[model samples]
Structures are given as structure tokens and as C-alpha cells.
Target: MMLWITIKVALRSLWANRMRSILAMLGIIIGVGAVIFVLSLVAAAKADMMGRITAMGTNLLVVSPGQRGTGGVMSGTQQNLTADDAEALLAKIPQIRDLAPVVRGNVQAKRLAKNSRTSLMGTTVTYFPIRSFEVEKGRLFNDADCDAMSRVAVIGATTATNLFGTEEPCNQVIKLNSINFRVIGVLKSKGDQGWFNPDDQVLVPYTVAMKQIVGVDHLNEIDIRANNEADLDTIMDRATKLLRKRHHLQEDQDNDFSIRNQAEMLKTADSMNQVLALLAGGIASISLLVGGIGIMNIMLVTVTERTREIGVRKAIGAKNGDILRQFLIEAVVMSGSGGAIGVLSGFVLAAILSRVTSLQASVSLFSVALGLGFSMGVGVFFGFYPASRAARLDPIEALRYE
Candidate 1:
């Protein structure tokens, strides 16, 4: 019953100066809102990135040429990966289910009157299976096409839309670098993958790409599908050793290539997202700290304004603990209200972001809980000193004040 009375008094005090209370809560409101908004956006972006990376394939490994060092100074990537290297790895490593040596270039693709600049990849038929890509229309080019150096092309969904619009792109001839190639397939949309948009590229046979388009004898990269994830490390080690032997590199020499697996890439991506989220959250949290200080400052002023009221209460047999509880409850009420408002505002902001942008902002319960808890904690931490000061006031002195 005494606690209830103290709460009632706190509410009354806060209600008496509604504007001041609101002003005191403004910092917390903005702080909590900013934290939620930043976290939600970051979570959404991370999910989107992970989803895109996962879509690339399971149990997959990518091999790319490593940077070469010239006189102890690292230079640009070495063009060391070749179709022969890919073949050697496949022949030597039983863990590899499928592999494709790739060469790519950015070129203007023209089909009749329509044209679009897009990445053109030259890979084998196994590229489709290795990357888990499905052909939406017609068919993917086969190994026979790669071996025969056929001028056949497979367009991605975005590429199809950009060049052909509503018209069907399959069977149409698209010219890449002034060389005509018949479109045999259209790939299903895989959406954006952050740095790369798989849907915006075209695929052709590696032989044709090497000889006619990119004009490079060396491969840019190799996409390999491991039979199982458990065998990935063994496969990588074996492939690395085989490649080293094929390149005639000594045991002490560094590898001229790099091997990256899907799991490692996903882990790295997750770590990066976590760091970004923490950085954003840390920056936003400064407002919360400022808000806490504001609460402390306001509570101090409130104590001064109500000095005689405190005296009157103490003179009427109210204990120091009761006075402390009253002021503390007042601070908590103010901050709690601000936290509720901030949460609503954060949700609205998240919804607006989702609607206005491509990002799919997601609000987790953890974030909501964290915001509310932090706000209440701030109230308690900052409210304590002022409440204690009010409780410790000399009743006679306070009552004698003019």
C-alpha cells in the first residue's frame, strides 16, 4: 500500500510538469529509436547477403589466381589458373563432384536494336550444376559446345529483360564484342549478391570465351563442387598439392592460387556484418548516454524545485526510503514511457524502410527488449543520485527556505 502511494505521488509530480518530463524523455526516445532502426536495417542487409551467398551453392569451392609478389611487393593477381589446372584437379581429387574453369569479361551485348553492357562468363556445362543455377527457358549449353568452341550463349533473367524486354530471348542471336552468338538458354533469377549480380551476366562456353571474346589462355577462376562438405578440406589440400606439382613449384614456394570454400566465405561475411552492426549500435548508443545525463540533470533540478515539498513530506513522518522511492519511480515512469514511444517509432521506421527501399528490415524481439531494458537501466542509474539527495535533505532547513 505504501509503494502504491509512492507511485501515485510520482505520477502526480511528473504530471504536474508535463512539458519538463517530456523534454527530459526526448533524448531517450531518439536514442532508443536510432538503435532499433540501425540494428533492424543491419540485420536485414546481413540476411539478404547471406541468402545470396547461400544461393550460390552448397559444398562449393572457388579457386582464383593469387596476387604475385615482385621484389617482396605484392602486385595485382597472377593469371595462373588455367583450364588444364581445373582438369588436373578433377582427375586427381576424387572428392570433387564437378568443376568449371571460368573466364569472364564485361562487354556490350546487342540483340537486334536492343543493347546492354553486362558481364559475359565463359564456363562449361558443369557450371550450371556447380552454381545450382537452373535454366528457365530452352537449355544450357553442353560440354560438346565447349569442346567444339560453339558460339552459344545463355542469358540471365535480368540480361534477358534488359536486351529483349517482353520478347522471348531464346533462339535470338546476341552479339558480344561484335561476334554473333545464338542464345540457347535463359537463367532463372538469383537476385543480388552484394558486390555481384548473377542475374546481370551472360554465360557462354569457356573455349569460345577464351578464343573469341576474353582472348585469354589462362582462366580467371574455377568453381568446384565437393561431393560432401566433410571432404572439402582434404579436397582443397589435394588440389593445392596437385596444382603445385603441375606448376613445377618447389615445396618452399608459395602457391600462386587461392582456394575459398562457401562455409569460410559465409563465416567471414557473418563476422563482417557483426562488426558493422556493433559499430552502428555503438554510435547510436551515445544518444542514450546523453539522454541518461539529461535525466540526471532534470531530476536534480526537480529536487531543488520541490525542496519544501520534501520537507513537508518528511515532517509528516514520510521516511527517507519513501522519498527515495517516490523520486526514483518518477524517473522510471518517464523513461519507461519514452522507451514505449521509441519502440513504436522504431517499428514505424523499420516499416518505412522496408517499403521505401529494397531492404527488408526486420525487428527482432531481442532488440526491443534491449532498448526497453537499457532505457529503464538509464533511469535507475541516473535517477539514484538525485533521489538520494532528496532523501538526505535536512527537513528543518528545507522547510525554513523562503
Candidate 2:
């Protein structure tokens, strides 16, 4: 049909000025590439963080020590959580599947002149299931150890390597805070999580940790797992009220503890990631506007250069729509090709960034679709004015211009 002929003519015109066409598309290329790269990196990071947070536990709620008021004056954080509070919550709240009272501190670990200052996690056996911890070597300490205040410890992979080197860590005695403790197990590696490395800590009974290691009777925090995801909010509310009543806090006074849930953490993470993507993607998309302008400028010059051709075709009965469609197709072809090349470049750049840098990057299908859609839209939007101008030109005036 005539439309196919017009497309061929547009292609021929672009090919005749290949260098100019490429230059016109360069802006689109960079703009789309930048958008893909930034958004992909953001997606990867959000996924990584959410994975780590979930790794800590699912349907989880953590109660940490919070501020309290003394003599009608606000005071700093107090040790307001205890094993009794944990027990009471489990007994009273039917939605609570399991709970772990945790106490942690920094301790110097030693084994035959090898020493490292690492974090200490003191909790009961339930802590493992609640926090998704699995033992790699030997066995986890049981309720008997906690009841007996046994000095058995579960060392993380990093701690094992640092303390005992290639020698077996399980059954080996290591000194923690100058006290001998037998290593009962070694935990599987959880990697360095940026904020804190879970693979670099020692685990022992909360009873022993309180009486001997940390020397504090109050728990540092209590972790609770709900019966299911649906019960998260209900459990959080009920636990908060129960704790307040247990502590005998008046309406005017603040409770001496704070509770947080995985759902809230997820929501906050999503919001933060959205803001990050918006800011970064917004900055990169500006180049697309610049590219559209370039395409419009080139199309305008093209209209002028082909004025006589346009007049000749018009005299031969080529319609105004034909001229407009031809020019518009030319701009679209240019921008569309640029978009394809840009997507490839963005994927390559994202892969490179993920490898050579600390940032995790992954090109999602959504990003590809978005980049392509935006590029093609630029083509139609910016190509319209010049196409319209070419269509409206008088055949006589165009013929006289040459």
C-alpha cells in the first residue's frame, strides 16, 4: 500500500543521513540506559534488604527496651523486659507461636593465642527456630543447658574460623570473657549483612549470659513469632497492651518497651525503595526529553532539505497524510532503534556494576518494558510538530523554495 511506500521512503531518507540519525538518537540511548541501570540497581538492593530482614524471621515482632518515666520526669531507656514478661506473653497471647528472650553483649573470644572481640547472643533453644538459625556442625544447646546454666556455646562460622582455624570447633573449649565454655555447635554462614554479621556471633543460654557474661538480670530484647502473617497486627496490639498492664504504667506514662513487626518493616522498606527509585529515575529521564528535542530539530531540518521532494510528490497526487506519516515514521525508527541499543547497554552496565561494586543490580522485565515504552513515546510526541508542518506546506511555495 502507499503507507508501506512511505515507510520505505522514510527509511531511505534516514539511511542517507545515517550519522545525523545516530547522533539524534544518542540522547535517547543514554537516557533509557541510565533509567534502566538506576532502576535495576534499586530493585536489586530492595530485594537484598528485604531478604535479609525476612531471614531474621517471618511474622516476627520484636520487643526492645524503651524509655520510662521516673517521678513524673522522662528517663533514658530502661531494661523493662524479662523472662517472666516473655512467659506471660506466650501464656496470655494465643496468637504467639513462639517467643525468645534475648540478651547480647560484646565479648573477647580466645583459643590458644587467637582472640577476637565478637557479639554474644544469649537465648533459649527456641531462638533458633524463631530466627531461622540452623546448625551446620554438631548440635544446638537444649533446654537442659539453659536450666542447668551450662557453659555450652554455639559458635558462628566466622567465629569458628577466627578462634580455631582449620581445627574442629565443636567440642573445643574457648574462653569467653575469661571463662571456659565448650563449643556445642557451629552455625551455618549467613554472610556479612552490612549492619551486623550474624555469622560472627556466639550463642549461649540466656540464664548463663545474664548471671555470668552480661551480668544483667533484665533481657535486652524479646523476639516473638505470630501464629501466622494475618495475626501480626493483632498480636502486636495485644502484646503492647499486656506489657503495659504488666508494668503497671498509668495512662499518662509511657510503657518501658517498644514493639515492631515484620509487616511494618516491609512497608517502610517499600516506601524507602520507592522514594529512591523516583529520585534516581527522575534525574536520568531528563535526558529522554533532551533526546526528543534533538529528534524534533533533526526532523525540522529534514523537512527543509526535502521541501522540493515534498512538492514534487504533492503535485503527483501524494496526499498531506502521506507526507506526515513518512516523516513521523522516520523519527520513530530512529528513536526505536536507539531504545533497543540502549536496553542492551543498560543490561551490560547493570551486570558490570553488580560485579565490580558493592551494589547488587538486576535488570527486571518491567524496567525493559518501561524503557522501551518511554523511548517510543518520545518518538511520536516530538516528531509530531515537524510532521504536521511538512503536511501543511503549500505545494507551490515548497516548489518555489528550491
Q: RMSD for each model, in Å, please?
A: 3.1, 5.0
Question: Any runs in candidate 2 off by more than 4 Å, and if so which?
Answer: 1-3, 12-20, 34-59, 66-79, 91-97, 104-120, 143-152, 158-167, 171-182, 191-197, 207-220, 226-238, 252-256, 297-325, 344-366, 384-402
Alpha-carbon RMSD, candidate 2: 5.0
Error of 1 at 402 (Å): 6.7
TM-score of each: 0.86, 0.73
Give lDDT tens digits, candidate 1, residues 282-347. 865788888888899999998898899999999999889988988888788778777877888899
Under the 3 Å rule for N, CA and C atoms, how many clashes does model 1 have?
Answer: 0
Residue 300, model 1, lDDT? 95
Q: Give the TM-score of candidate 1.
A: 0.86
Cα lDDT listed for each candidate: 0.88, 0.89
Cα lDDT of model 2 overall? 0.89
